[model samples]
Target chain A: MKLPADVVSKKNGKHTIQPLSDPKIEAKDLDFFYSEKKALSDVTITIPSNRVTGLIGPSGCGKSTFLRCLNRMNDIIPGTRVQGKILLDGQDIYAPDMDVVQLRCRVGMVFQKSNPFPKSIYDNVAYGLRVNGWKDRREIEAKVEQSLRHAAIWEEVKDRLKSSALDLSGGQQQRLCIARALAIQPEVLLMDEPASALDPIATARIEDLIQELKKDYTIVIVTHNMQQAARVSDFTAFFYLGQIIEFDRTEVIFTNPRQQRTEDYVTGRFG
Target chain B: MRLLPKSFKANKRERGIELFLLFCASVSILTTLGIVAVLLFETVDFFREVSIVSFFTDTEWTPLFAQKRFGIWPLLIGTILISGIAMLVALPAGLLSSLYLSEYAPDRVRRVVKPVLEILAGIPTVVYGYFALLFVTPLLQKFLPGLSGFNALSPGIVMGIMILPLVSSLSEDAMQAVPRSLREGAYALGSTNLQVSFRIVIPAAFSGITASFILAVSRAIGETMIVAIAAGQQPRLTANPLVPIETMTAYIVQVSMGDTPVGTLEYKTIFVVGMMLFLSTLVLNVLSQRLRARFREVYR
Candidate 1:
């Protein structure tokens, strides 16, 4: 593929036809626990810059748990603990001096269920900017428009910016959530089954959106749908029972996985 | 043969049980209507004797005196003054404590503290009246040398304390009822705990919190014992909290206890005041209900 110039620059010529260099995030021997129960065990994977990396597994397989660990979101849950390291752009995120707030701004999240604030659509997009102290009204307005456009929902919402966000349809709400995350200008986006709640058409729209978004932002998505993982991801990691079973290029993982378990899962033999 | 009989006995029993439940529900509703009816009837009689214009416009409130002035302002102002003070004390304290309970408190701490707070609500209002008179007034007198033994300030503060559980408990419930997903969404945007709380959780729970505030204010306005005992029976039109003043509830208590003969206009003053109290609280309750219904945000 003839890579786009921006993509080449973003990854420092580490585009397709070469091995990934300078990963955006690297998890090394990461272990996680919720109180006494271990959720993720010795999970290590590299998420390359400017690519959609999909984490695929069945329920309770710790794929979602691993996604949350990237931003230290699990910190909010009581009695949860993380062991080992998750480094974002070569710095340890769990270090004592590292601010989790700052880290989250660098890595935004879209939930499985679109959770827009019970506020106006304009205010919902402006929330992240306001919290991050973006004071200029003109700048915020421009950014809000730009973000909504980037998420591909600006045209539908432009006329009724002051309307309650809860009034939007399911697909539009999910896109608004993406715009909300994008407004912060995060370098990475974490999506946990972002389309699992939507219909087939809405899911297709979201999948197309992921493709568009990956050109600018490193995307990490967790989905149970094998075809979704095959369609959207550049790199795919198959997680089973709190561990990564296989990590490879999406095509290889779907077509010719090395591990027997990966093959079994990909072929729908067993999960 | 029919697989199942018609079971007319079971149907009759169900109908009987439903009728019993309906009767139980209607009893409370009927009692409320009966009270309102009596209040309306007596209030009409009171207004017939005392001109409606003078009852509202006149400033003095001495229906018991030889030169009986029938102005309602003095008692209304007194109720306003005490309720204002109580709200000033309760609103911030209740909201902040509710925020703490909902957002900051650990599971163990909440478990211990919630029941302890409800115990404050369960304490008898008569006991609170004495606590205001015997304890809080003396404590205030140390700081406020001009404070009267029977003043509105002490009881107002004590009433605030008494209603604090109501405000905090209800507000905390509202805040806690804010969906966890909303909190997570705010947090995911790099919002600090305070930002997430005030901006997102509070706004989301706005209707419930406002309902709690209105309910608390109504409770404070209708409160009788604390004001009756600790606040003097003087129906003064002044806003001064340090001086003695009588609320509507307190004035009713005073008239009901005094040797004034029933059916007399002086005796009828209690019903008039009771009618005013009933109307104000009824308005507040309806307003709160409207607010709760209108602004409640439903989440899936």
Candidate 2:
């Protein structure tokens, strides 16, 4: 397949593909509405594969709404409407032919608050696989172990796999939710402020886990803390009043922005 | 000493109101204690005439007849059989309706449907008895050929309908108490609506659902008017629900309506049966409360 020129840039004339430079998801002229009020207007951005993209803005700036759009989570809210094209792997996700359940499987999500099911830790992680029709007990168990190990919560939870997920500490519960999301083996992960509720130690653990996860999966995270964006993300998008003010490499966004609004916001002048 | 300002001092009127509220609370406690005392005193009198072993073990109960028998199994069996039939009708119907109301119904539909269903509960139990005798018994006889004119089946079905709203509303509350976050989490994992409702939401709300079921069972046990009218006054120790049987509540109502002497053996039997009903419901209510506490702890 011929990659779109704007989406895939080259170092030289040689044909080479780096996953960081390849666009995995593209949103074009996206306008979102909750009933009659507009939440996101004419927003366009591309998320690259195998890279962490950070979305940072104040509350109600539509960063979380935009993250939910990738997995079509907004569809659950009654009276919410969307008018745009969200393409995943060059296919428009909002197309009539798209299977939303399958799309969600491909693009999994973690919420601002960790929500572990009121079930044993093992059952919580295996829930996705079971719903997707994995009936073999041994296969489900192996996948649960692998996902827990991948989320870096295996050592703390392996001994108490039968214990309720709610019994885990706040940080461990968040990691269990991540493992639950990962057990489905999604290509992209959408995290809406996954560490906002945790303490400093737990926040640091989640940050480290995100870094390790970006090697295998595409990650798009929405955060209020610019420091977290600078530490974790390869690419950054700054949203202001339902619009993307700037999209660039994280270092450039932090130090050398072309737009005055971006510069003012980066310097902590005002939201 | 400086004079205390009005704002800094407790108001006498508020104190009076607090005393009145405490008095109101004590009234309910006093009523419960009074009921327990009556049951204990009358039960002692009845046990003096009848042996405990005969009351429990002997299957036939013919207390008002010439050749009187004091066996309690007939009344106990009738209570159990009617309650069993009522639960068979109520639990599935009530739970399914609640699941539909809470999980699937649109806002407009739920607004209209819920009150209409609760209307069933607001109807007087006496009215339910007449409906069981007139409408339900005849309708059931068409399909169940062996059903009697006055059988446990009709009253059981009618009583189940009477308690349907109780089960539906309480179970719906429990299901709704399962957080929206849990459903969203399940949806994000690619679960269909059915999968999310059954696997995640239902299991999370299990204890509350069980509590509601127990409450419904207790309500069925204490029901009287429907069984008194539709189920005949004969007390038989039979498991078959098609036959006429008399429940404990029905016998109490029967004895109360007649001009029995104050200290008669028949009058004392009412208290004995009342004690049994009270103790069973007491145990069920305690279990329901414990389950509710465990459920609350899970989410917290």
Candidate 3:
């Protein structure tokens, strides 16, 4: 768990690169395209292990798109193309021999709208394990219970394991989705504005769960609220248009960013 | 009547228009009631001559013979046999086409294929009957030398092809209406295309698919022209689809074409058979509606 040495930069306007404590994922010189239109350009960043990293920007700034690139979720969208390297533990995920399904098993995602399967609460949590070829019924039940407990929703839904997930309230549904993602025991969890559709109370609960989840899973969250980013993230990256304006510790990004655009965005000058 | 308060006031013209719309809505209901009344009145007269027990239990259906026999089973069995053959052809073709159209086919391919499939439904059923008599029957006779000139097999296959669009189109709509988020959710769990389409998408849309299947079967039961033209007018109780047999609708058409007296027992038989067909379809439609309501609570 040693921090990598800082790489000195010659660019005067950009912030100097800082060292990271054991980077778990890295994107280098990445370029993304949706058909003919360019969406992201030469983006590069390191995601540290056992920490929550927040990506903050206004609408259509490619924050969610960037999050999806980590696990190749963007590949599902037709005619979209990617040109860059995304590495997980020194192995390139986009390599020709790499198995995308295996990569997705190791890295799970929660959508912004909390898309739970229209199944029972128990089955929803056990879906990943079943799909990955788990056959033992006892083991599946145990893992489902453990994942639900980990997501902090087991107590509320323990009595209704066989009930449809849709019967639960909105916050419970989002938690059930998190439990489903966790059931696969993924090492990395990607959250795409997981609280945007929830109420203030539900949003607070999700924030707390995110803080608890970082101890076991490397978390990367995309959000529109700068205050929420500061509240939940250890590291913050500010994106503008199609590039990262600044990437640094959460405290530095909020209080004293080197880039003028980062300052304008953080200080509420303009989105 | 007392004058209403300002907030509760109703405009006279608006009330008139509302009453007119209500009347328009009741027209179909009134027509259905009128049909039921006529069927009941004729069915009572029919039972007076042909005993109710003999109509259901007797196996022979020769009402025009010197020694008359009245059994409904022969006609009912014929109807079931033709419909069964039609379903055997229609179900797999319809389901596979819908799965491909919804899950596997690209947008350009769907655009080119869907309308072409629906054209089968738009073609007149009488034209389908002619096709059975002219093309499909001859093709079958070549393979099976024992095939009859006018057998249930030809009309059954033709009717199956005719209803392909109904089954495929309805099933495809049901599958397509499944939210994209569910597909994404399955993919996020590392499922392949086949797994997502079959395990997640199909199960989620099962109610709608079942309803469409039942509706298609009802349509097959009600088809007349194709069976009448190709299937010979001989009421037999056999299950062999290769033989010529008259379905209930075909029998109705057969009697209607002749110059039988309006109120005779020969003419009253049509009403009784028609009542049975209507009742079966009504039961099927009600079951389909119930299934549709049960599983929709999951998504909506």
Candidate 4:
């Protein structure tokens, strides 16, 4: 349980820092750029293990960009670059020796729009396992079933596992995407507005699922809804114009935020 | 109780414009029907003189010989052999190049290379015919000394290269149409670039790739100039690629350019061959259209 050097140094400083019981991910001075335009500047945050950390921000606030940076998903975009370090459990993920494929295996993600493969529900859930070289048929089947149950969509889809995933309703499809991510058994799960496109009841189901998921997995969620952040996250980080304005406990952020901007945003003032 | 005045002149002008547009749209359709009608009538005339059973069952196709024969197996086998060889060469190479273009190439590189590759499609097929006869055949002869100067392999390989652009361009377009979110999902699941390509992108673009393959094969079946010049005018029912052969289109070309008298049965043979070629391509085109429609529905 060795702490990352930056976190250790910050703990000894003058600022009253709440001690993280176990920090699973730490970004130190992370600056992101898409070609010439800067998207994130000097972002430094510590995400605790087995807890839901919510990122709340307005449009173009770099919350989604920050979530993608956790798993280096932005590397796929041409002319995008990252400066500084993102340490997953004490290892630098951006280090030259770090394998991107292995990093992704440990850090899985669900997108805003549910993008199930043009395949069956069973196949979609089993894709990550097969690609990772899983050979045992029974094991894969068990894992797919377990993941679907964990995502709370097992009973809805168990009878139709072989049917095309596209036939599912929007909420079911999003839950299926969550199951797909869960089948890989990553240490950390990143969700980018997983319920933005869903209705209120569907959104409630997702929020409850997040609460259940944090028992074993470190969850980082980017959401535009302040209430969602308040409901699901243990810790909340507020971002504006690509910089973090405040990071505190969820109730502290919602009820007694230090910054005026945080209060304005939480109170439905101005974004 | 008229709410507004109706202008008869304006209504008449609108009707006139609609009729003009309809006529323009029907021009191509009318021309296609005219061609099909001509082919059908001429094919009927050819069938009247030559019995239908022998036309298909006979193994020899020496309609211009002293003892006339009407077996189409030789020409049909020749067409299959050459087109099969062409597909063997084109399918893998075209699909690999398309994968490279869609998934690997940088934006700047793709912009330059894609248009350059398409230039191959613009090159005249007649030039490709001579290239097969003069350049490729001689080059192939160095390694394969037993290769004939006018053989199926030379033109088949050349025809593959000639049609390579069509397959790659269309396949690349299909692969590129796969959404970025799908690719990101795969990548986020610990899949490498190659894995994402083979497991996700290719499957997503399956119908498009299949359609491209069918269209390319149909084009190869309809190709005349290259096989006519390099495959020789000898219609032999054999599978060997290193021998002279005559495809269906090549046979039609040979007969049409020969001194066969008009209104004779020998002269009418070209239309029958033409009808077969038209039908094969028509079926392939319809099949490709269906596959493309399915692809659109899935992705749209």
What CAPRI class is candidate 3?
medium
> DockQ for the candidate 3 complex?
0.58
lDDT of 4 by residue, B99-147 (tens): 9999999999999999999999999999999999999999999999989
Q: What lDDT is reached at residue B89 by model 4? A: 87
If ranked by lDDT, best first, what sequence of candidates would result?
4, 1, 2, 3
By summed lDDT, the worst window of 10 consecutive residues in model 1 chain A runs over A1-10
Find the 10 residues in a row with the least total lDDT in model 3 chain B. B1-10
**Which DockQ value does candidate 1 get?**
0.81
Query: In candidate 3, what are the lDDT values of residues A1-271, reduced to their tens digit?
Result: 1122443232578867755548899998889999998888888989888889999988888899999999898887878999989999989999999988899988999999988888899999888898899999999999999999999999999999999998899999999999999999899999999999999999999999999999999999999888899999988898888788888878888998888989999999998
Candidate 4, after superposition: displacement of residue A222 in Å?
0.4
Taking the tens digit of each residue's C-alpha lDDT, what string does model 2 give over B210-282? 9999999999999999999999999998988888999999999998999878898887888999999999899
Expressed as tens digits, the lDDT of each residue in B1-300 for candidate 3 is 366654346576678889999999999999999999998889999999989999999987876667878899989999888888889888889988999999989778999999999988989999999999999999999999888988989999889898888889988988987898888888888888888888888889999889888988999999999999999999888888778899999999988888878988888988998998999999998988787776565567
**Model 2 stretches with alpha carbons more than 4 Å out:** A1-21, B1-16
lDDT of each: 0.92, 0.91, 0.89, 0.92
Instruction: Provide DockQ values for all models, in the order shown.
Output: 0.81, 0.82, 0.58, 0.82
Candidate 4 chain A: worst-modelled 10 consecutive residues by lDDT: A1-10
lDDT of 1 by residue, A75-170 (tens): 888899999999898999999999999999999999999999989999999999999999999999999999999999999999999999999999
**Residue B261 lDDT in candidate 4:** 95
TM-scores of chain A, one for each prediction: 0.94, 0.93, 0.93, 0.93
